[model samples]
Target: MDGGVFANLMHGFSVALQPSVLAYAFAGCVIGTLVGMLPGLGPLAGISLLLPATFGLNPIIAIVLLAGVYYGAMYGGSTTSILMRIPGEAASVMTCIDGYAMTQRGRAGPALAIAAIGSFVAGTLSVVALMFLAPTLASFALRFGPPEYTGLLLMGLFVLAYMSGGSMLKTLAMAAVGLLLGMIGIDAMSGYTRFSYDVIELADGIGIVPVAVGLFGLSEILLTAGQPTPPAIQRPTLRQLIPSLEEIKLSVGPISRGSLIGFLIGIIPGSAHIISSFVSYGIERRMSTHPERFGKGAIEGVAGPESANNSAATGAFVPMLALGIPTGPITAVMLAAIMVHGISPGPMLITQQPDLFWGFVASMYVGNVVLLILNLPLVGLFVYLLRIPYSYLYPAILCFCILGVYSVSNSVVDVWIMLGMGAFGYVLRKTGFEPAPIALGLILSPMLELSVRQSLAMSGGSYGIFFERPIAITMFAAAGVLILLGLKPLLFKRKDWREKVGLEDQV
Candidate 1:
């Protein structure tokens, strides 16, 4: 409503609505769907490989394309998950639970249809939330000082720890490692480089794109190399792809609730689509009258978690745009991309850089439409992607990742760093640890230090600063309770027991 802000926004829409940007948006969606339809290659890797190409593009055009890729992958991932039982990314893993089951039972069409619809509904709903809520949220966040940020960071770390895979001690160690990795760049206050290792390549610090792609993409290829290739998918026809009206009616409530839950969790740092999907699945199962139907190809199972995952992907954009915080690893890559183009995502970004923000927002609407068109009619095309031999697919993914790493500032050193991280990621995978927390820590490192130091300075080096602020105190307390609950064997053990009981009954 402010004159300057309104004017800037109008300019942003002008750029976003341009015919050329729309074409790039469509191209990004198409590429995303293709990569997402494949099992090993994911958006992070795809974007990493493409980042070098975008270097020559206008910042707005580049981001519009990348954002489209991001969400289109979300849509495409569900396709492979439902039809082939292989998740395109970590978040889509939950979709495999019921989706693959539906495929086995010859319900692949309805399953894919439901997922596509749920993703569209959730993505649109979250975008609407972003349109109206981002400025408001940024205004509210302006009140935050050092104590609040510290509290928020602490909460982020704990949430990641709780949500990470088995072995709390190992997860803690991984997180510490991530926090230390985050300390690699220069110390903000003193202007001292803490862990540069006398290397010039590190002076600008490690790029999140190479690190993320290495961890998630390369490690995935290595992991899949040892496992048996997934079973082939039986293609579904157009008639099979369309869900009945009754199925749509049944899914509406879950899709709506999932959008809300996914969006809220996504705004918090360290929360990712995986966490949202799992939580959404649990909630949907509990609320369903026939909870037993969940693992038995329940329509709600396919709808709720897919919607939540996609919505969470959309919601993760909010904090990145408003608070200058990268909520997850993928967005961390996007943040790095923005900064690499000499732009920062922060509070002033909205007013000073409304063209970038609103252009990106408008492009999302166009991207959603593009995704539906590319994903739906071409559902068969995407399914065909699953038919590619693992031998060929894995190598292509590796080659792309290698090229992506080598392309970063044309530094061979980054390639070495990427390989090192890939090996480390493989180890973590073998040990049942999720790479996401490491990615979270790597991205949050600089922010964490800034907050910690600022809070200390504000409190004259007193540690009690974190406890003094009400919002900070509340979030930390909630984090503490969740940590205790996570460590305790009660809820998860009970839930596992119940699931076992349910499985036995079916047997």
Candidate 2:
């Protein structure tokens, strides 16, 4: 099996390294970076838009280009998060928490550089995993039935809520709000509207773009509006752009952990790439000696989540290539492109269309290297955007963000919705409530609801199915462990408690 895998991967390189294929891959990376950095357009939108152009190209070339865009956006989105306190896309939302904090603390260069480096390492590592472990992981992923999804997603939410630095109640409340907002659109399983309230715009529910832009970017602008001295941007020195050896040392653990976490989580379909970053962030905070530094510009916060995001993006290819199941929106589009070319996806795909499968796998290597090359050289230049006067810069960013939001649906209502969300976010921040969980809830709630509904329906409304299934039982048990671990810190909060309880704290 090892020999056969190596031979197939070598064959894939032969196809991917061709001049035309490499050219398309480069173009895709460039386009993906631009799309991801831009306010409204994400990798999914970028892929959807460019998909038609690939219609005339060979299926392999088309997938290569789209694949490049998919992961390239993961790299590009971090720039917005670190530089502007805005998420370029949903996956970068967590990046904004620490990445932007680093910028305010004059560590923008280190943040950007670490994000890029971590992304490269993780992307490369995930490809290796994809190359070697696709079949086994794909089979493992198949064990996640509706009941399993219910348990896993529940555990995920519980773990994240438990790991938050703020009040768990506040986080859960925000998440509940997110879940409510997510359910606004008409039901997909049953064509019934729950919260549209006769508003046509709400019929499709709120877009994550508008909500995210409003919550992070617009709210930021509003916060800056109140500051009398808005001189926050600074030009980083060449020395500063390069991370110190100590900082690099801090990132090693996070990057390696993120890569593994992202790849494993990425196997589960439906927003797994986005979810991987959040999961990584929680894990990092839990593991860090200085858990308190998490939202305070900790390099680990940036490194871990960014690495996880890119790797998860890479990891998403596993199921599609091995099992014909699209793991996320981007892979779904890529699969559509492949099927349009009359290529069937599934278990036999590797045997029947080894060229497509292996070549697609190999192209990831080329794409990750290309993205790293594209990103590193531009890090210093991106940091310079902060040097611009906040007076001029804020309005420009605001316009781009608004335009990005509006462009998604061509609806002015979304712009208004974004502004409203921004104001709400500002209020939340003032009230010491975190808005990040809200975004996660909005994104994951629908999937969770669908899984729970399916699981219940299958068991005729018996909740015991979640406990009866072995995988589901494992997930619930994991959630239970996370809960107890989360309680450990609280139970030993006294000054002398750590010595007694063995709870490690970063000095």
Candidate 3:
């Protein structure tokens, strides 16, 4: 690292290690872990809820706490995915396929350990990359016009659909539905409502929390409720929690590859963690010598996706800190937190507010270590949660889901929306439709629409603007390639796409 950058980082460490800052970081980590462990609650909700509390604090302290929550939640989400079939966050969904499979096969200890270890390594590495890359990348992103953003968002969605392990047609269809739903609120350019039905709540469009909670959390509950008793868990002893030499050897390559993939994707706008995890899982599956064992119980499956998710979380900070752009919902909240503290995050933030920028970066390194220490010993505790009877557990989960949705905006309308989505999700899943693509579509649709409208306005309604820009052309070409590759299965129909792609089989 440059001497100046190294000096700034050392100063940041000095600031972060203060008693008050350390206390806030520790508190944030604990609260974030608890929030992430619960279904329906994620970094978005956790940061939003605590945002009010940080109003009285200094910017650095507040950011330290909030940043801790952001990455800490990533760590906690893996525990739920591995112990139960539930993913605590959207990014953890890929982990569930092989993580729970490993649990069922009495390797839960190794899986959990690998996830924690891999997350630590990836998180730290991403922070290092973020420190060096953010300024350079931010400068490059200054050239991005609306046309470029439009292409980037479109490419991201296409890539997600292509990587999603199911029928590409079905995934694209779900994305279409999501786009329609995302259009329900008022149009930014026209200032006219599209699908609000004159309801005040609908004016802001649907809350992602409701949709995510309903589709993944409540639908899983309803599906599991209809099943037979869960299998008895094989609890591993303390010694077994540590991975064997051979298992570590198998995981190292995946961990390294996943970290790189995740950091690169995370710098893009939207929820890159979900895409990163899915992409990592796909890459690991393809690269494995025993590809057939992937969905069954592959250690690389658990390690790669988990590492990617955490690394992606760290990478998200680059845009928010360096460019004042919120990559996803969680960072959007963090942006709000910074603004509330009378600080605007942008290109000048590092120069004008060096302490806040570097201190936040330093806190990440501390938070990652804290999470590793916190999560390792608690692996057994989380696994023990799976022992509770479904009859008792499902009801509690239902209550928590309801509470979480309501808490988002204190709107009963949100709760109703969640329930409606839950029912829709259950039916959709029964029909072999995955909810993930719809969620992604919902999240990206508004941004895509706005970008398109802006691009057209800049081009005086001309269609040639997208192709004229080099970055836009590159992104569009990438999107086209992904779309064609995704459609290859439909064109050929040579095998069951689900089996060919290692999609999760219905339990």
Candidate 4:
């Protein structure tokens, strides 16, 4: 290890291992596990629901708590997926196929054990990668000026919109709306508010906290409430927690491949944890000698996807910490929390705030170990948590969301804003729109606007600056390519669309 990197990491462990920090880290993990095992609440909601409470916390500690929730939820999701055919979060959805199949075949123990172990391995490795990669990236990013930043942020948004599942057009539409909404507050360079009407609440702009909690958290609650409650869970005994040597041997390759895949994909901007999980599952299924064993309690199914999701979840930190970009909803909320605590995130953050940077990194390692320890021996306890009915749980969560958002600004207006956004979110959900692009758009809008305006100002009101810089041109070109690639199917789909329309009409 380089002296500089090693020194920063040591300082990080020193802060992270302190008794108070450790206690809060433990609490965050426990809270994450509790919320995560619930059918609907994912890390995004979990972080959003708890954000307002961090108003009084130290920046590093607040991040330690919230960051713990992020990855802890990743680990927690597999429990219900394996036991009850319920996915604790979006990433866990892939696990439900073979995980539930294993439960039916009375091999849930092996599945659960492999998932926990794989998550630990991947989580640890990814954090180490993050520790190394982020600093190097930040060093490289030091050369970025406003025009370069403008192009990069633009690239990020387009790449995110294109990679988000479903119609790229729909995702871009949501992103544009989100960016417009994010522009409601103030023009940083011009000192003028762009979209806020005469309303008092809109003056400082929409709070990301209220919007996030409402859009992802409350909307999910409303959607789940509209459906019938899930069936009762079937509990598995702890005595069967042991995985056979054969099972462990079978899992090794998937875990290794999944970890690498997840880490690489996680660095990209969009649905990475979920994407990595699905991709790993596909790869594992294809690589299997006994391909037919898949979807029928194949251990590789659980091992690969679970590891990939965790690794990807950890890999997402790279961009956020290094370049001040959010790759997904989880990082969006984390960015919100850090910014709310009055810390600016960017390439300079590593040098400007090494403690916060490395401390949070070290804390992730601690949180990973903490989750692994808690998840295994306490499997029975988590299974009991799954048995708790959504009937009773949703109401309490609804109340919590209300209280959390209200606490953000101590304003009833924020609460109303939250409810309004929640309704809008439900509409989006029902209509097949992904909320992630919107979340990214909303969080990143101000930065995007700032960069563009700054670039324009530097160019003396000319648009040519974006094209003049080699880096800026490359970024814009990359975004353009992604857009073209996304449109490629549509460019050739006239006959296919007609065939589908004809087939649907016959149906």
- Give me the displacement of residue 332 in model 3, in angstroms: 4.4
lDDT-better candidate, 1 vs 3: 3
Measured by lDDT, the strongest candidate is: 4
Alpha-carbon local distance difference test for all models: 0.80, 0.78, 0.80, 0.83
lDDT of 3 at 17: 91
RMSD of each: 3.1, 6.4, 3.8, 3.7
Q: Which is superior by lDDT, 3 or 4? A: 4
Give the per-residue Cα lDDT of candidate 3 at 18: 90
Clashing pairs in 3: none
**Please, what are the lDDT tens digits per residue for candidate 1 over residues 347-409?**
667766777888888788778877877777778876776787788778877888888878867
TM-score of 4: 0.92
Model 3 local distance difference test score? 0.80
lDDT of 2: 0.78
lDDT of 4 by residue, 313-391 (tens): 8898998999998886678778878988788888988888888998899999899889988888888887777666788
Report model 3's TM-score to 2 decimal places.
Answer: 0.84
- Write model 2 residue lDDT over 150-241, tens digit each, in one string: 88667756655664445666777887898789899889899998788898998998766667667766776676653454334545555677
Candidate ranking under lDDT, highest first, comes to 4, 3, 1, 2
Off by over 4 Å in 1: 1-13, 164-169, 487-507
Candidate 2 lDDT for residue 455: 94
